[model samples]
Target chain A: MTAEPDLDRALVQHLADLARLHLPAERLATVLQNARRIVAAFGALGDLPLESGGDPDLQPVRLRTDTAEPPLPLDQVLANAPRTAGGMFVVPRVVDG
Target chain B: MTELWQLSAAGLADQVRRGSVSARDVVRASLDRIERVDPALHAFVDHRGERALADADAIDGARARGEPLGPLAGVPIGWKDNLVVAGERTSAGSRMLADYRSPFTATALQRLQAAGAVLLGRTNMDEFGMGSSTETSAHGPTRNPWHRDCVPGGSSGGSAAAVAAGLCPLAVGSDTGGSVRQPAALCGVFGLKPTYGRVSRYGLIAYASSLDCVGVLGRSVDDLALWLAATAGVDPADPTSVAAAPTTGAAAPAADLRGVRIGVPWQLNGPGLDDEVLATVQTALATLRELGAELVECSLPSVAHAVPTYYLLAMAEAASNLARYDGVRYGARRGEGTSCDAMTTASRSRGFGDEVQLRILLGTFALSVGYQDRYYGQAIRARELLRSDFARAFAACDLLVSPTSPVPAFPLGSRIDDPLAMYLCDALTVPASLAGLPALSQPCGYTAAGLPIGLQWTAPAFGEDRLLQVAGAFAAATDHHSRRPPA
Candidate 1:
């Protein structure tokens, strides 16, 4: 009965930040406008009632059977690390603990 | 040498089998062609010239010893960068994996190699196969061979362009949405996306798991069929791989479409399609009707929702699949940063292109707990409706035909700023992909400006054999598929 929702610039920027996208500041307005347009275009789905039935299409996430295969050598696994110390991939500590 | 490069895969194989042309000669000609044209096209991302020659020479030696070789023996084919080849860098046209090499070869590539096909090189593609055109590729765009200033469609643009420019007679590509068909149409070649699960997906870099299909680009339907026969089959390694008999034998040469029922959906008859493209498809339909097929006008109202459904589903799947690229276990790693989380964030920020990042964000949002039912769940329901629409249509008709793309290849940067317009280009092709049906794009005609237009034929799941038969019949009746762009 009502018009579908739209995405705003703030929302687009939030998504971009979450995705770690480096969109140029100059292009944000245009990207946001286009994103809004696309979301609006897809709003037709809101008119349909999709809640009547059980989720027949729901698929279970089948985890692969765990096997005790030999692990890769620590050196080989860390070979491509940008920085390493004491045979471990080193990174800046975030948590105080 | 020129003639050899222009020969269809079947023609080349026949000649080599009869000893009229040596395997070495064909490989040499292909390598020479790549050397001559690829510098400008940039179709190939990596070259294994010496290795390809060695493979060809070994095939020739086997032939001399009176040993039989595979059907496509010694023919050169380019692999799209997303398919892993053991010991070769599988970059997916991204700097994130620029130095990363796969320890395993794609099952499809391995099968092609066992069939004696020479690996020409890896071709360019969109970064993570995200964009409609190759402009989003970190390595740069692959130009349309028809008009260098125009674009070859993506994310299989490089493979399509290479086949069009005579860099290779055939190439392997992956289609999600319209990646294979759109590019092949833009470049004026034959591309086929077999029914989902027909080809193994093992070792292919996943973009959208359910939507991705490995496809083939070739100069002719016969060439495509040859590649399909070699690569399509069940693989225990890929659970989605179907356990069905191969369908290559159904591609018998047929001259008429008698008794075939063709459905033309009305939603595909909209204003976004170019006038010339519509005319070309209408003419093809008229010709098919004249040849004795019944043309049924059908309404697929649900098709209007196909593009959005595809995007939401694909982006959600892509977000989940690409979460593995967090700069820790594999691929490009950023220097030590404040924390593991910070390092991954910065690494992905600098690594993925704008389009890839955008989809990842959109997908993550769609799958977020509170929004899941509102977005991702609704999209899935829409996809089911689309599938049911196609299934109902197929019950009344044997095949469905539509224009491969709404418009012919637009200027390279025309829609770069307008993502909606760009996404609309795949409107017609997405319905078939959503339904997991097989589809083929064969050159139908040229635009008034001389760019190529494609006529797409789609069939139900496991209907590739029938689709190929119809396409082969159509190609035989017309010369459009044989017309090459003047390089």
Candidate 2:
């Protein structure tokens, strides 16, 4: 069971970094192994004619009226926030003073 | 001689409407059934008898006041934990939101609740609809009612097991791939994944936004038909939902499939298919033929690649859909780090289960810059070809049939370690999911091991009525659906 060229650990690690997930070295091996098998599963698509006749059109549009509505109460909206301060979500500092 | 818990949604609704059975009686029966069976089955996770009984009492009060009741009046139904119900804990079977409560209700549950369906509680599922077996749930796996050692095929295993074990008359599950249909097959119950966009998905926590749909599980075809009809209309909240022709009316399964054209794909046979499942499906097809259906052989070549196409596309969408879970705004926070990125990554890695993390990485791998065209682009093209194949087949036949699952309810933990083998179980059910067609899994018969075997049928987009009609007809002609698991 060989992995496709791009299904290696380096590629999966790169993908993890891009996706902002923290995968430990041990976990990376298992994830990469399964990812390779996944690639193997769909590898046949590589040879299919690229003639895209139909669009899967992943998302459908909803037509909403122009009417405006009230947003949920600020208190209610922030209730589930893991960290909140001064009526705003408090994320770790991304900027230096 | 049927216990109140054993009645179908329609039967209980009719009885409640006529005052022959009180709503409290129905809800109490469901709660008692849950108490007696759920310890072993683990079908339901978050539940409160007081809340359920209260809601049931309200329905009874409405009846006493001479008010009109919704079609699902007094029907005890379970909502898959992923579907938010304002103020209810919707864990989505993940540790991230294990204690999270919703501020709003999903449109699907809202519609069903409005129609008088009692919320029995939240049913378990594969974390974020990721696994084929319920083994992936953070809460724990839900067991098949037929054999406790086997899985109740998931990610909708809880709902299916609930229905099969007579814990509830109906339950709602989200089907991104074959979640609903596959579990329904394993549990010897009826499950339906409507044509994509046929049901509103406003608050179904997105797994794969494009393919995810609100699906229903029930013991009787009539209940599922009603469940669909009540919730299938377009909603402003879910732009993906379509305003389609109603799904059911005068809802009798046709006496026979006299003029129905059922297409059996040549792809149904092959290496991966189990011998017993193949034989069971063949017997069911023969029954349809005896009912006068014209069975035509069809080809869907792209379906051979459905697993990859479906998984690739689903994983990609899931990767994007799940991005909102960073710990700053919602869900539990996992790590303390100086920078937002550090905290976010730690939270996600700690929050998600192994299966969810693996998919996110695989999805990211497919959509990464250099390989986007090679994997993501080709998978989308594969999707197009699959849709075209379905269209061509439909041009010749009104319906297509396959085994809902390529195998029966397998023993728990058999494929948990091997994700690929577990994913391959979805081979038969994914074709319809990828094509966005309406499909239903009906109990055809059982294997010698006593596990349920499902017979599936796919109808063109918005062909739910036809799917129901045919399933109902078959159910009417056979006693397979009525067989209960021994105590």
Candidate 3:
């Protein structure tokens, strides 16, 4: 099955990049092929009369009384960090000149 | 000999409470059953044998001391790998967290443990609950108990197979889009996805946050009720959890469905459904009518679009929820890149399987600029329509009925290459999940090939009691649920 040229293989690759996933060239062909089909199927939503009915309000308000509670221990909080230094999670430097 | 593993959760609990059976014996019997059946089934990935026996002994000791115990005093149960057990490896069936351990227990498991249910182990699942078959698990796929060559439907296949094979009396699995119910249907067991917010989602690693719910699978409706009673309640940890009391009373089997109005959706019976499965569901509906239910025709016109809507919305949420899994956190890390972005990309690509990566890409594309309105916005609107459709249908009927899946369990690897075909298997089950209604799948009958066909009953939110009452009535009247898979 031919992927609709309009869906753009490059665009899907850009999506993979945006999602921070590195898909090899071989997998990209299959991903693009499958994604276009899926996206086209999802296009069925266009058939619905979404113009008249406003978006549903699904968000619920949850408020609690301000009360003092014990916090998690710093060690426990840092327990899962892949890299830690000086009592904090260590990530690659963000501010590179 | 009829072993303790063969008894239902309620029976085990009652016997243990009355001192007729010791908890250690029950645990040992379950452990032995696991040893016998799980070799071919691959239902469990982590074995908590020592802890399970210890916990069981504590139950026996507590009984000796005359301490008060909960109704599920000695029931052995499995926790689907997605739910955390303190210090236990909860991979969510993924290689990313294959070695990651949790610092805390999930609220549902904590509740069950508090209620005296013994944790047998962590069951297998599709990685991050993404696939329709257990084949996606990093550990390995769990096979159906009925026929070892077939898949136990997933991503809750492990829990379903465990219960069906008598490895445990009850197990907890999360249903994002029919994860729990689909597997239960295929495996010929009882599975229930409670009202979305009825059960707490605390420590259930997110699949699709809005749709994910912790569900239970068991051999009998009574056991399902008993398991739900132990776990359902609000938790401060889960803001979405509703403030409803746990449903404690198991509905006794009604002699007749005197006032029950069951609606059958005209859309469910279609070319997509297997002939045998459809006929079995029809017979089950006939049985319900014989039991005095008033069957009415109902239409949820939006249900035909459920798969696309559910995938779009769920994948979008999944993409966002899974962003926390960069290499800097608790999961496996790869690539010694100088830049954080490079490291993250490498880690994720190396960590996730094809299915997970595909969804993330699809979700990213849907949420990207210029496409959000056309895809994400429309999916949300479609969800609203589906939810409203269910509400309107419920107004006309006390409950709705449908075949749990369009077909019985397909052979292993049949749909692995075809993503769309696998997604379509969830056609009937997804409407209930997307609507956040309480739905249960029970063994209505089986096919000539000995494959089970599940009959699903769905009720409006918080209608668990009425839902189980009708299911219990049907189960009490039929012998379908009692047929065990051949040894």
| Best candidate, DockQ | 2
Candidate 1: RMSD to truth: 2.4
Worst 10 residues of 1 chain B by lDDT: B333-342
Q: Name the 10 consecutive residues with the lowest summed lDDT in model 2 chain B.
A: B244-253
True contacts kept of each: 0.34, 0.79, 0.62
Q: Residue by residue across B1-487, what tens digits does model 1's lDDT show?
A: 4488898888887887778888889988988988888888888887788888898899889999999988888888998999998777889988888887776789999999888788889999998888878888878888888888888998899999999988888999999898999999999999999888899988889999888899999988888888888988988777788867787642785678899999999888655788899999889888888878889988787787788889988989998898887777677776464567767877887788777777787787777756677778888888777777888898899999999999998888998777778888899889988888899999989988889998999998988888888888888888887778777
**Model 1 scores what on Cα lDDT?**
0.83
Per-candidate DockQ versus the true complex? Answer: 0.40, 0.64, 0.56
- Greater DockQ among 1 and 2 belongs to 2
Write one digit per residue (lDDT tens) for candidate 3, span B343-395.
Answer: 88888899999999999988887788988877788787888888889989988
Scored against the native two-chain complex, candidate 2 gets a DockQ of 0.64
Q: Write the number of the candidate with greater lDDT, choosing between 1 and 2.
A: 2
Q: Could you give the candidate ranking by DockQ, starting with the highest?
A: 2, 3, 1
